[model samples]
Target chain A: MSAPESILKAENLVKKYREFTLDHVSLNIPKGYIIGLIGPNGAGKSTTIKILMNIVKPNSGDVKIFGLDYKKHEKEIKNRIGYVGEVQYFYENKSVTWTGKFVSQYYKKWDENRFTALLNDFQISRTKKVRELSKGMRVKLAMAIALSHDAELIILDEPTSGLDPVVRREVLDILMDVTRDENKSVIISSHITEDITRIADYITFMINGKIHLTIEKDDLLSNWKKIHFKKGALNQEISQTLSNVKEGMFGSSGITDNYLKIKDKLSAAIEKEDIKVENVGLDDILISFVKGE
Target chain B: MIGIMKKNITFFIQYIGFLYPLMVLYWFLRKDSFDLPAIMISGFFFYLLISGSVNILESYEFKNNVYHFFKTLPLNAGDIVRAKFYNVLIAVFFLFTANSVIYSIIIPDKNMQVFSYIFILCCMLLTLNIIAVLYIGFFSIGFNKMGKLLWITLILWLVLTILSVEMYLIKLDANLLYAFISRINRMVWVIVTFAGFASYYGLMRIAIRQLEQNYDNV
Candidate 1:
């Protein structure tokens, strides 16, 4: 009956560039949950993650991870946080094993065996130079590093971008397995809605640096539905509750964010077979939001 | 911090490996002229060459956005800045010590007073080079801007070094300068060395602050 505690809380984060500004954005990520941040390009997802990681300073904002402030506890906070940037950066000439050894020195709880196991499982050659690996392999290497450090919170920025479907699925499955422990949390940012839908327990939709919605995955999918009805079936009162309404010769269709609220109101139309309802995918919902509908 | 230091040392080793053949060739050409001042000037020239090449390599690392990788690790700005400063200090000290030892072996006279003066001179030059490298590392505007600035700095340093050597060779007052340096008490030398170290620490603090505040821009 009690809500889960937030492992990461960000309040009114603001970062301004010459051309774009991350408007007053805020977020709360619950423990043991996967939070998928869905946004289009330049929507401030990477900027938000950078601010959270303290890689980029915000003009105005406060971020707390595990009840610790970055200003006073940067090393302590970062030690427990695993971050993967959009582009994997490493010494090109260094072997994979060398890179691992280099990174292991910085983490207090780095598990060497686990890292070696991950490298084996990911099929990344220990002696291969970083430049010799493919993009998918690079992502796996980054993921292996993130998961090898006993990190309490893993923040991935576009980790699956440009990967083949198989590799992407593997990455998602790895993330899912991480949350199975019930002590770890993940915040993954991506524009791919299907990947988010597959693994995210909570979904946050962002547009132009502002968070448009944050809701439970099941709640969002179940409550938000598309309704196809006769012209007169949807009254003005019920029509007001719907969004992205489209009228056609066959019938009119509209999306409703609160299907349960309007279920009783549409009972007559449903009973008479004058209206039909269909489940909406995250892509549909995201497209509607992106079009400013 | 140790990890960062190791990474820098690795880079130093790699660069030095590539430059070793050139260094050998330079030594072969100038081995006949080895003397107190000749050794000092050649050592200074070699320092400039190594530092310049290393600066370019450091710039390449920046261009590749390697700091992003460092930032992702559980490291604060101070750790990174200190590691960089320590790397420069250690490299300069190692080079000067090797130079002094080689000069003492090759030059038959081996005057203790002259060696002491040269040691002090090397220390001063090492301090100046360390400050220059650290300043450039922290405040590099951009890759192209850094290249241009490096060229300007290298030219200025070379001209100043050559002019000072020429002045010492030609001017009668040069003996007075040497006397002034030799006459300085041990306490003064200790204070000067202490001041050099203090400035190194102070510059490191400033670099750390700059990095913390302007990480994205850097």
Candidate 2:
């Protein structure tokens, strides 16, 4: 869209497995912004990230990182990307310093001073073996390595999955700091909507390997509403207008992005006090969509 | 390339220790003045044991999900396979030299023919190592398949060796077997050695292409 001022653009990415298929997934990650790829487990979030990283190939599609063809300029594009996957896979017997030294050799602009500073900031011991470190510490180490490489775009897949809240906040803050410079950007995929809302500028919600919505965070929040209707009022016409609906003993509640249109269609019900509308948070919106509520 | 080699060496350090028993066995066998065939058979098994550590290294990487880590880096499939090839060659060279030195020290009466024989054995083992890396990396064969392949190959070699030995004793007589072994001259040895190295790089190129094509599966 609009000629892709985006640092990362994936078009028509398709990958098939026995149980899952990432069906024609496409998304543009704009430059100088954080776009959260949000979805539930098994929603193809990791698959999409893998395709972007070239860890897995798409059956048919094109991915361009930094506007360079992913296949043709993979080495150059990867050099500019700092990525941390959902699982940590450092040599378990090696020290943190060894892992850092091993990884830093691949990056042209690896900054040892910055790496040391980040290690100090994160309180990770450089001499400690990777196997001796906890999962949270390993994540911090990964983040520190990713940041010290002068990467222009950071792609994190569930980087905060197992961390304590304190460390999670620290990681998010570090990501926010990365985006402070207008030239840097981030694309984080997570099931935790709150984490995305805390740091993301835009949101892309995915379900069953298909993208459900891609909108600005503020726009999504401003437009989507969870409307409740009295029992016997949720007829076929009203149901057709809502994206997801759940009926209970007392009434029916549903979500709709076209709040104004839904309100106009049910003006009679509104005046008669049969329906009420309330704003939905990012968490509620995602859960409603995921649960088909 | 040097960085990847360093990583592999470090990872394989624990495995190289297992070769000490083979060295000790070499000493005991030499004390009894074992025949050339017995020594060569022992050498083959020792080579197999040493190179088996490479399989261990691979299993650890696969178990820990380390393949994707390297795939995500600024390294192409050829670069990755080249690193592995070089690393394994270096390791094999080290182990081969160590085993040869043990054989030489324990069996002090051996002539120049022993050195030539060792050289041929080293080249042959190196060729097998290169071929193994190509097939395993290109096809994404896991440890189970590799273990099975190794077992089947070893069993087949054992059967062939027994059959050859039986034919030598029974049909052709021992003189015919000795004549065949004697016909291997320096020129032929040099040619075989050169061919071994040539085939190694040839397989390396093919493995790189296969790796690039099937990188996603890897």
Candidate 3:
């Protein structure tokens, strides 16, 4: 990896509240790759996006987009960046067409073709007032607006949240399309493991107010594992080998790899008795990392 | 600038078309009282003009990630503010001009005496509104911090009008025109209006920089 194709990066980023701080978080989103910042609720995902957008005041740190400092190239950076916040609130009384028409004047690269195509693809009525749209549709309309412009980097917070499974799939499909162009990239924060698994080549785990890790998807899948336990595996033996169990109950009723470890603990007889072991999903690693058990 | 400006103008025109006529009718119905029409028009103009700058809420939305949809566009934030304020001013100007013409035609003698008075009163009303908007916007910082701003504005405007009543009285008399000409000039009024507008414009810049600093710490 001779110098990853970088599109967006935040360095030593720190934003402090009375009670919480982002704690010197840094991220580099390589161009053309869909990066997922996966975290549980209250993990400072939205805060980071706000800082990157230059929406909030930062206590310390620098944000660079496409290798340009945010302070010097704010307008230029903004032109290339598109953001959809966790909560989508537009002028409720305004029609989609009115909002679209108004936004068209602000972007030099506003492609009316892409705008209309996204509107149709998402099945949002151009005549519909923003207040009338459902949460899923509101998110879809936001995505449409974010993508209509020739944004080099799209930052989204909980874009798939509160959507039905079908709608979530649709949103991810659009995201996948956005990343097909090598110059385009996305940094989406989501709780949806499946969405991250589908398109995110790079995943960063955020816990508490700080980032816990940022690992490539291939490294995660290749290294992480879920070890299953069976009856007669001594509880004391299981505890000795698997000390990092974040959540799961014993009693052999369900199949959960809460006991996943680098070393195996099951008896040789049980290992050959049709028991199963598998790689961990983001959700599993995320739970363990976040709970920090 | 043009696109956002057009949106604000479109909104103001639609709002005033419905609201102003009702205000005029209210004045007509209440004509049993002396100078109530003038008072009513002045009050409406006061709020509408001030509402242009008193946009703590609008500024909040703009400062929030809410406007990423718009800010990411080519339009500048100040352009949006100017467009909003200008739209309201245009609406206010139209109403004042129309009323001035109608009053002149209806009661030439009575209106002429009242015209200068109303003109100055409306001017003061606009100036004060602009001042109020600037102060509220500056200290409140953003819409979320506007609790005191709203109440203070209401109380301050109330206290101000009570003080300006004497000036309004002097305005209605022809002899006072000599004093008025000497007391205030066109350039002074421009300076006063722009001073208020410029001060608020400067506050917005300060707040943006402060927010950026806060963001970097996160």
Candidate 4:
């Protein structure tokens, strides 16, 4: 692959837990781009993000944010980068006003107006202690703090994992607003690929602790077209020839490859018989990827 | 460094402000005395010097369900440890302040030299504060064991205090208080403590780094 104009890059990151190993994973988020790190549970998405944020250290890997090594430029990198995880720990005893002030002291570019605007938008009371807020409200508070910092690069790990649809939409709307800056970028992870497809410029599909594919969101949507055919129309040879395929029979029919190779093979099949090829969504691509077809 | 130090101090002061009052009522007498509040507050302040630091590390656990949140924050292990220490010191010192202020008010012209006694107590507690932050942050003991750090520290301090008192009661010199503290030899202790603290902070940093490297949930 050519050298990407990446703002955030993780090179050959390795980490291990009791049963799962985060294999040597390398990914890139280009400058001025929003990317989705998409993966199912136990897929090491959060681990990889943690490594990038310098919350978790990789055994041996390089994480660079804005072209600076994470370890060498920790203070500088952290001051500029904002992160909102699925579950953030706020001091249960402290009110939002107190914690906001506390966070502002750590960040040089904290914007009180932006924070208050987000808070007001969410209808969150600044006087309420964190412990009293519901899970959704807690997530809102976390997001508010993350966005208030005026960070150029915001890394969100599973930001919409458990929120209701309305809250999720609200988050997406705010992210949409953030992208208007042109210089600012976001790297977000979610099981919900639709959200990723909506906002992401680039997308990486992770499975079993490894990144299966890293494709541009626009390229993926435009280029990957699912080919449908009769059950006996395609053979093992065609499936083997295609690099990417979704092999399964539905209602006495077969759906196969999404890549261009499928088109070449299916054209040959269509000459023999009438067959239908259809457009594929991000969900279909992810399903095929997870199924390793 | 000072900013970090001030944050920690504020944390510790607020801790004792609420916690020690709860402890004072734990042993309310059946009949009230002329200076009931004063005695119990002073006693609890003394209890805090040693017992307070032990509780400092556990407060992190008490404060959050998942500590990995703290791990992922921009803070390093050194900051976490120092914050806990400063948090405890500030809380305990202010608690002691409350006790002394009320004690002097309740018993004016009292010549017990309570303020000097509190100074000695504060020094002992500071050592406990440092030691607690180092050990708990460095080790991966479960929360149960983590909670025991304060209890263990309190027990150790109690055992030493009993022995020191036994020596004084048998030989009864007012200078024995100074003698006990001098035996600790704060200046030499400070020099030796540099190595201990370096090792402690170093070990905690390594442990936190290890915890970071392995992406274990919770």
Clashes per prediction? 0, 2, 18, 8
A best-first ranking of the candidates according to their DockQ comes to: 1, 2, 4, 3
Instruction: Name the 10 consecutive residues with the lowest summed lDDT in model 2 chain A.
Output: A263-272
- Model 2 steric clash pairs: A244-A293, A245-A293
Q: Among these predicted structures, which one has the highest TM-score?
A: 1
State candidate 3's DockQ.
0.31
TM-score against truth, every candidate: 0.92, 0.85, 0.77, 0.78
Instruction: Give the range of the ten consecutive residues with the poorest summed lDDT in model 1 chain A.
Output: A265-274
Residues B1-218 of candidate 4 have per-residue lDDT tens digits of: 24445655565556555666665454243223423233333453466553554456355654484356555445555555556555544554565566555445444333333433444355434554445553454345544555666566556656666665465557756454535545565565666546555554555555555444432433
Give interface RMSD (Å), model 2: 1.5
TM-score of model 2 vs. true structure: 0.85
Q: Please give, for residues A90-120, the per-residue lDDT of candidate 4 as tens digits.
A: 7777798977876776677889999999999
Tens-digit lDDT track of model 1 for A1-293 = 89999999999999999889999999999999999999889889999999999999999989999999988888998889988889999988889999999999989999999999999989999999999999999999999999999999999999999999999999999888888988999999999988899889999998888899999999998899999987667677777888999888877889999998889888854455878899998888888998983
- State each candidate's chain A TM-score: 0.96, 0.89, 0.86, 0.89
Q: What are the DockQ scores of the candidates, in order?
A: 0.78, 0.59, 0.31, 0.33
A181-277: candidate 2 lDDT, tens digit per residue? 8888899999988899899989999999999989988777767888888988777887887877888999998888877666667785455588888
Docking class of 2: medium
